[model samples]
Target chain A: MVTFALHGVGVSGGIAIGRAQLVSHATLEVAHYVVPASRVDHEIARLELAIDEVQKELTELHGTMTRSGDLPGEFGAFLDVHWMILNDPTLSEAPKRIITEQRCNAEWALTQQMNVLIDQFEQIEDSYLRERKADVVQVVERVLKRLMGKPGSLPTSVAEERTILVAHDLSPADVIQFKQHHFAAFLTDVGGVTSHTAIVARSLAVPAVVATHNARQMIHDGEMLIVDGTNHVVIVNPDRSVLSEYRLKQSELDLERQKLKRLRGKPAETIDGHRVELHANIELPGDLAQVLESGANGVGLFRSEFLFLNRAGLPTEDEQFEAYRAVAAGLAGKPVTIRTFDLGADKQKAELDGLARVAPNPALGLRAVRFCLAEPKLFLTQLRAILRASHYGKVRLLIPMLASVAEIDATLAMIDQAKESLRERGEPFDEGIEVGGMIEVPAAVLAIGGFLAKLDFLSIGTNDLIQYTLAVDRSDEAVSHLYDPLHPAIIKLIALAIAGANRAKVPIAVCGEMAGEMTLTRVLLGLGLRNFSMHPAQVPTVKQRVLTSDVSAIRPVVERMKRTDSPAKLAALLDKLNA
Target chain B: MQIREIRLRNAKGLHARVAARVVKVAGRFRSRVVITVGERRANARSIMAVLMLAAAMGATVRLETEGPDEQAAIEAMVAVLAAAGDRA
Candidate 1:
């Protein structure tokens, strides 16, 4: 057996040894023949019919996705992207040109058109576009399958056994279809780190190495392969010693995973008796199960945006009430910190329609509470729903993107209006719900004293705080490399926010991407952050770190880190502390 | 022809989603629109062509529109590119 290795950018971290499952339909075999002059119109019509079917299929799939319950906002966005690709004149009109001018069969003509489109995508300097070449290929393949009279069913899911999926590229739809099967790892010839497939792989906790260029061509079906996603290496047909070494590594990882799972029941406290609250940031009502399973103390950030997304028109108060009630009831009296409608910015604008403007930079535009405040009718509807549900369980109101005390005062005033209106209607609701604000903006972080005076609690939204402070958009690959969480400025900001909250005796929490990261848990704890709100899947791992860490040991180190001038030194200091 | 120069203020620059938005708005006008970033020129109404320009967050691109709705088209395209306070 020929043994070899391939290197790729590791998008997710883990080690897996699985049988390679080649999912190659890479180049569809299409016959090129001159269409009869009279039948040119007929061929064009045939292609149009196939396009209609594909669109119909996509519409149905989008419907299914809206109902899927576990997916993130990106899934819907990618679906829309694919829909746009299908409808683009490049796809529809260009192929017809080949069919009419060259008198070629629809299938061959479509392939030629797709090649031109791919070439255009390939020429785009943005690597994001280069990665999107897979998306173009996926769309073409779907159409080609239809033109060829073949059922375009995605390879029947990843098999039950530990299977390393070797594919030219797996679309988000294909990944969703393979939902039931267990995947040890995924290696694709095409896919960027930001692609939906890569995002799903990370969320699923499966090891994945993408943009490998030719993993599908080199790896044979049913062959034993070792995927080390952490190292960005895939071992094909490893000899006896190598295979055993990987087997040992895999078992160790399995044991570590089990150990983390066991930490679910343990309290998240540092070794020196500093107790910290660990909560989950939930995206949907369905996530409550995972939250409870992970033993999170409460729901820290219940992103209410999900109800507003993928639906036509605004969600009625009753619909919002029902969703909030389910989560409140699900938690069984555990405090649910509901952040009101952090919509806009990366959210689909289809539902918003004319209500929202197309934000050029949504990250800084009318989003979160700003959108809520501007659209008071919409804001009041959500506030009324949240207030209505507060009576059922322990519900805390959290406002996102609070930059000034004036905004807070206005929000509080609105809350009073909602309550008075509720009182007049004789609606039963909780009158003393705890109010909080997300310190996402750098202004908010610095103005924590103002918030602490008016708010019951505070949560740092480091995701945006880092982005705004660093002037780096994490989603923008062009500047994504500069998006650093451990930068001295960020650490200093977090420390200052926490210190301010601590001095004022206001409870504080971190509910951002940084909270979910295991390595940063210790650093955050060191910075005097006593509460962490992250995804449920992250709770156990973070709790494990919390269990082992000594706050006193890290406090001094972090104090020095905050004073460190260089960004490199700041990172080194954090690494040293973690070590 | 009406020509207007604007900077990409969106954090992610004129990426796919931004380009899609640009194409959608540009397509609404009868005007033939062209966007020029640095040395590269792209058709404002075509998503692929607009994306090829690869305008980063701070890059300035000139929008040129020629038709009956030239003024309106340039204004709309500028609003999208300048994504001003209503960030992406």
Candidate 2:
């Protein structure tokens, strides 16, 4: 068979070889629009019934998704949003008018109304508000088919063994159903670069290739293929040589990944016994599985914002406590630092009502402590959660975006309130939960003395510090050249944060993309920042870097960078340090 | 009910890296999807389809999908096509 190899976007990691079936995604087969113009009321009633059926499915899916003690606070919140949309008097009432006035099919009517809503969402300046359009559209798509009695036709139930299904995009519903069968791999055409589908695929370790153009049209049924998740390579039919070569490489990668697994329970130390803390930056408690797989010392940064962003509304104290408790319990004896939500103005996900605030630059806007101060109730619930979770494990509460002594005082005051309430309710907690602030803003770096004096510990968020100090958006291609973490200013500020924290006899660490980079690993080690939190994949490489260097030997270069002005000189210094 | 034939203009064709990129991008739409490259065609919605296309570094293929999202379907396909080529 003539084999074809394809290079596409790799959203998830893994490898799979399977036969091809150029099966496009199975879509709902639209039956002919049979509704008479005269029998609009009767047709409308039928549409309502169909919509009701989909609503029932949506609700049912929500209930089935929870672990006995573990509530899906985020997804449950999404369902709440869906529930509201389902019963929204305006949306419900408008469709009827469309049916009467347009005399159109209910599906068409619903789609049009959704378009108007999506348009209004798009008009809002906030990207998060606009992204909500996706959720709204998803709910409508579910309801429309039910209303028309042509509820979307799900894919022909197939035993997914050795079969890789490709699609443009998948709804949360399809993902749940697809997981039931043992799929060889998955591919999609459209998902936000860092979308939920990508998150799910990665979580499942599915060899997923996304963003393949016309994937639905390009694949036929039961054709042999290979999906290389490492480089996101996919091979359809392979000649003998390529096939044999890939089989070898696949085995090698498996063995290599397996070898890394053995590194678990081993200390991340240099050949000469220079121990370094290698903790993982876990966004969710579920991420603990991979963190342990990588043999992380602990979670250096638990992004608690996920609890807020993942859910639809504010999570209750009990709900937040349960989620945090799971993470804390999973860590067992290891330390897990929980960082509170750092809501900023630019992020539409905040959903703070009636604050017409647009900052000239969100990086410098009312974010983190500033935003938390603005919404005390939101901050208090999270504080209560972290404090409650502290009893379960070696948990420490870390706050982000701290700029002043006042922000620190105000934050602790709320914590005090939470403690008082818990005491009143007679709920026990770790009263001695160590509280700390992340040193990210330039102001925080300058005011480090006051923070270190009051705070229990510190973790430096290098991404923001670099962005704020150097003024660059690392993601924007236009200023990609400006995204230099090794800039003398950034290097100096980090050194200052580390030095200041150490002087106060407080432990400090760096947890950002910069800490994960191979080049900067040694520089940070010499700067007195011994703790590192990074992506799980980056842990091994960073550990490798740590093992190669003596921190004492690496200090001179860090010192040299502080005295330099030229980028060329800095590059030369880095090459020397790496050498 | 429609089919559009297009050439993969990017010099790299549908290489492994490009195919993964294409699959990642194509997964964003919601329509019945498929593609054909020569006598072999796979579900464009399947990683196997684009991988099967193996249209070399620069090749041509046809795309088809049927649904209310067909327009977005075509545009997103072409967008990934151009992006995959560029990335490749």
Candidate 3:
């Protein structure tokens, strides 16, 4: 076979060599033909039965998703849409009318009705609306597949085969279903980085190349293919040398991963004897497993917002208490710093009742501490839960987006109130629980002394600090490039915060995207940031960086870089330090 | 017939999720409901029809209902739309 390669967006990073398995788009070739009038009722009944089967399948898929502790809110909504479409009069009633009037088969009749809907969608001016045609197509195809006796499931006989799945397109639901079967990688002719398939692939740590445009057509079944997800390239029928090179590269990666695992129990101390405390920032209670596997020193930032997200209604105090207790107990006595529900901003989904009015710029609007303070009842419930959980383990409360002394005062007052309520109810809680403040806002960094005076410790949230200092919304595509974490002003602010924490004799930790980043770890260590919190997946690699970081030696270099105003010089300095 | 004019409220607009919400709310009442956007009208209860209406974020559309529960239907839809509009 001739050697060739195809390029596409490599969304998820990994490598896999497997036989190609084509997953055809649900598009069916419906034969248009007149049916005998006597068989029309049978045809309609067949269509109804098929629709019933599809609904049952979707409902079961939804049930499976919910039981798996996945985002039922998202998958359930999609399934509900498909179910509604299947039961729609236009699909069921109109198709039956077509079958009787046109004397057509159920498949042909359904196709006729689907075309009418697609035509209407095609006329819509909005591109997003135009995209709904695909959803309609998927639903119609599911019905057609059922009518044709093709179950919407992977062939179990092929489960043992190492194969790369090639599809015209895949919905998020399809991605989840495919995950059950062992596929070497995923290749789709249609999708982007934001597609559900791509997102799932990344989270699953599977190789994926999407938007190949013609992968399903060009790649034949059982053809040997190399899916290089890291480069977004797929080599078809590679030469022996090329295959050997890839084999060598794969082994190297495997060995490197093995070496990193060896660092799990090792302390994140430098060769020069600087002991850096490495911790994990957990978004959900489920993330505790990864934290413990990564052997992080403790849970530095337990984002308590998970209970409020991806679902409707506020969790009761008991629900919150149980979630907190699970995390605290799972940590097995490691210090877990739980940040209160930092609602608003990007977390608009967490606001119960959706009562928070739309803000032109939510990042600067009613968010974090402001939102919690405004919703004191909700705040108190969460506070009481955290306090109760503290009794199980070393739990601390950390307030996010603190800028003013008055906000700190208000939060402390509420904390006291929550404790009083718990005390009045005779609830057991750790009275000696330490409360920390997040120095994210530039103003908070400047006023660190005031915050440190009242709080037990401080965690510098560099994600927001960089954005606030640069006056750029890092998420905004247009101005995102301007968000410089290593800007002179940002470095100065961090140094100032560290200086303030030292003078106040308060422990300081850096917890944000910057904290986990290998490129910035040495610089952070040089700045006297002894405590670091990040995703558990990043722990081992960051620990590796920490082991090599000589704080005593790099401090002077970091000091000089802090004084430099030139962006070019700063970039050069960072390169040297990271090297 | 009871008719009311409302703007799309959901910041992400009348996407699949918002359209699904609209369909669910419209399905609650006994009224025969139709929503008109620009020159196109769609059955309020059909997910496909609602999605096809393509009202988009901040787009003003007319909601028409004619049945026993016309007022209740209109109130529910208008309330949902306004809530969706409130989402950032």
Q: Alpha carbon lDDT of residue A517, candidate 2?
A: 86
**Candidate rank order under DockQ:** 3, 1, 2
Provide TM-scores for the models.
Answer: 0.63, 0.68, 0.71
What tens-digit string does per-residue lDDT give for candidate 3 at A271-360?
799898999987666566678888999999988766654333456678788778888988898999999988889854623554557788
- Candidate 1: residue pairs that collide: A360-B88, A361-B87, A361-B88, A362-B87, A362-B88, A365-B87
lDDT of 2 by residue, B1-88 (tens): 4578888765435643445445555566777767777766756644434544556434577888778787888778777777654421
Candidates 1 onward: DockQ, in order: 0.09, 0.01, 0.24
Candidate number of the best TM-score: 3
The TM-score of chain B in candidate 1 is 0.91
**lDDT for each residue of candidate 1 in A1-579, tens digit (9 for 90 to 100):** 999999988887789898887775735667789989999999999999998888887787778777765554455656666777888788888989999999999989888888887787787665555656666778777888777776453544446457788888777667665554677888999876655457567656688899899987898888999989889999999999999998999999889878888787788888999999999997667677778988999999998876644333356678788889888988998999999988877654433634658768788888888888998988998899999999899999999999999999999999999999999999999889999999999998876778998999999999889989999988787999999888888988999999999998999999998999998888888889889999787888889899989988998888888888798887788788889
Error of 1 at A354 (Å): 4.0
The models' CA-based lDDT, in order, is 0.82, 0.71, 0.82
- Assess candidate 3 and give its TM-score to the true structure: 0.71
The candidate with the higher lDDT, 1 or 2, is 1
lDDT, residue A164, model 3: 82
TM-score of candidate 1's A chain against the true A chain: 0.70
For chain B alone, what TM-score does every candidate structure achieve against the true structure? 0.91, 0.80, 0.92
- What local lDDT does model 1 show for residue A481? 93
- What is the DockQ (computed on Cα atoms) for candidate 2? 0.01
